[model samples]
Target: MTPLDDGPPHGRGREIWLLAATFLVAAAGMVYELVAATLSSYLLGDSVRQFSLVIGVFLASMGLGAWVTRFVDRAVSGFVWAQIALGVIGGCMAPVMFFAYAWMGEVELPLYLFLVLTGILCGMEIPLIARVLKEVGAAAFRFENVLSVDYVGALAASVAFPLLIVPHLGLMSASLSFGVLNLLVAGISLWLFRAQVSRGLVVVWAVALCALSVFLVQSERMVSVVEASLFEDEVILSQDSPYQHLTLTRFQGRTRFFLDASIQFDSQDEYRYHEMLVQPAMALAPRRQKVLILGGGDGLAAREVFRSADVAAVTLVDLDGAVTGLFRSHADLVALNAGSLNDPRMTVVTGDAWAFAAENRDSYDVIIVDLPDPKSIALSKLYTQEFYAMLAERLSATGVMVVQSGSPLFARQGYWSVVHTLQATRNPFVPGGRLWVLPYHVYVPSFGDWGFTLVAAHPLTPRDIHLPDGLRYATPEVWRAAQVFGPDEADMPADVNRLQSHALVGYYSAGWDAWFK
Candidate 1:
């Protein structure tokens, strides 16, 4: 009878353990990919660059491993033993990779090298499993069936990881759990395929045990090293959210916040920047009763908005729930902002800013664009004409919008392109109105001195400016002078940028390209 029949003493039951081993291997291997991609983005600044390169490197290494599988002795014991080694390495993948760069500083070189090594070793598992699965049946349902099931397992893991695994389990726990799964896989293989194992397999089991142990003890150290390297201070709080690593660290009594690898704020002196961002838009806005705040999860900008008693409703849209939730939960933050997040008038929505804004239109009088600098394409879209048109649609004819435009002197094209974009959106009624460009600079501890450009639909005269009684940063004179730019920062050429087709990105590239080089 065939192995499919349940009546057998050995046919199907024996092969069940082997196939389960195969499934675990596929799951574990894919987890390795996820860990590498996610961790690199967390430790490094650029998400696109980190994810794409690691995927390419891992795939190439897997192919090389598969090719090398041809020459090795195809003993099932030897193959299983090597898988144990891969698990051990991959077990430490997150913690090791997390701390690797901070400890060594050669993150690029050894990171890719370890990735290739893990991929090669991981790739070796399926081919060897297929060979063993072939031992059962030969004529019709044989090696091909086993291979197809392996593919199905891969498909399941790919879906489960981003949706079920990451958001639910987070990094440290997920890595530890997968490490246990891999070890469990090795132990089961040793039991089910006992006749196939060797004396050398003892070392393999020992290594997996060691990795599991290391993952438990030293993972916190990994985070500290990563935090220290990424931020110029001691890390106070760090979390691996489904979306990114949420980190709050301390330097010189000032607390700094980060998402993934990008600095969100240095809380000690953020008031200077937040005050400028919100007050300008609020002052010029025809009515302050209805307001929309985009991407100001820190609530510092929201705190500024809450200052005006005239405001009736404040709608805050930020992507990460963790950020806003922290603002709501932390006693210090809530007290600092006068519990602005929990204020009866405030509404917090967590999700993508682009999608959220698209769904709601013409809903508010004032919109505050308080986002990080446009470092990647995701952020660049917010600066696009399409997004600006949405903002313009939502604006009351008398209503005004202000964006936290990046540094003009640094990304002159980037700064001016924003202005050009605001002008480019063609509507029959509002062909083009008036534009007022106010460029200003502030010192941030993490980013050093930075710049922003404030624009308005109507001519915003100095006579139009006013602030609440409790402001610490801006006075009437300071507000007027804030619009003043120095000789070098002011002398932006005519060719610096054209409307709609923003030269800001190119300008920013030229300015910051040297640091990357």
Candidate 2:
């Protein structure tokens, strides 16, 4: 007959409160992990690698934390202090990383340091809570109960993070808000077990809570200042959509659009890019009545597509509605695209390009793949062999499809991988059961040495295609030179990008790293 049989007078109430604290700390721990992973992905280009490293390092640190808790003789005091430490460290993680990246231009050290510290603190929580629970509990199964509640809280946090937290509160506010929760758990635990915690510890908890509250209140301004430092131009629009962060900046009458801190286009010379992407396919296709544009949410490609009067109906599939909405409604953005998004011939679908291509029965005479670089898994799927096969199914017999491949000079292997993937695609209308691909590149001042791939059933060359009027950069001579890759920019051996392998992402990452890093 020990404490298990005859527990404290209010043992049941104590168990419930301790279990609640366990649930809260677990949720806060998961949120901090997510915030770190997301922030790293935002600052770094390769999301898959960044997320994998963050999660792996965090889980390992947690195991280390749990192992270290055995040295603590006082579980209640240990748990409360760990919570206080986590509250301050985890809460300030994102804002600090943001500022570090903005000012220092390198956050690898800070990112990993915060990750390891918060993960260790999070790891200590469960074992410490279990020990405290056993002191006042009636059964040995209290550990299992605490573990169950911890898992449920993690599930809740994972679900809410992508759906509610990131989109609504953003990374800065979300981290600070969860930090507040961590402090609340600490303060509540201190009050519940007042005899166990000293007065100094209680004062520490109060100060942490008040400081986090101030940060939460001023989180928006803090983010604005930090983000402004990251860019040279004045940030006019900064928003976090479900898929990615969309930012618009203006400098010297030129507007630039960025997604996840990567520049998408500059308004001054966007025509060079858009014209090269859209005009080649439109000119080569035997008929250009129906057109489909994928991933060009800014409407710049659509503006080029509408240049041809033969196009009767155009459907643009873009993942982010915020992007299309801005281009459609905002006076400055609309003027940039010449109101192409609001054109009567345009029908915008705010959904995934792959899903739309898979489900739709309509065939188009021209299809333009104007998506971003394969910096992440999400974008990598667009460059996969399976996705190209799907597009081939929706392509009319005489239709021409063009893909905006990455820079041929900078990302030579990545550019060739797109060509190889398209070449591997089997189309019934083609003679060899393989799509005919003609890889070409153009030099845009904003984005140097970019490439595009034109695919069709039959063999086609730039000489046979007709150039449209009112074009700024692309011309018959420019088209010919674009096809001629210099000896230095010659094709490289690469693997075809498939859904399972996503080999293109690796190629893209390696190429960019060599040049930029």
TM-score of each: 0.88, 0.95
Q: Which stretches of candidate 1 lie over 4 Å from their true place?
A: 1-9, 142-144, 167-173, 221-234, 250-253, 409-412, 427-429, 432-437, 462-464, 491-510, 513-517
Predicted candidate 2 versus true structure: per-residue lDDT over 330-411, tens digit per residue: 8999998989999999999999999998999999999999988899898899999999999998999888999999998898
Model 1 lDDT tens row, 1-517? 2222222335566577677777777887888788788777666545566889999999998888878787766446656665776766776666666566666655666667768888898777777776665654423546666667677777877788877777666665567667777777777767666655665686668666676867666666655666677677787777765677687777676777777666777777777778877887788777889988888887888999988889999999988888889889887667666788898999999988788778886567788888766655556677777777677677666666678877656665566666566555543225555344566666555565556655555555557478887887866666677777767556354232333543554555566664443
For model 2 the local lDDT of residue 188 reads 78
lDDT of candidate 1 at residue 104, scale 0 to 100: 68
Worst 10 residues of 1 by lDDT: 1-10
Off by over 4 Å in 2: 1-9, 138-141, 461-464
Give candidate 1's whole-model lDDT: 0.70
> Each model's number of backbone clashes?
3, 0
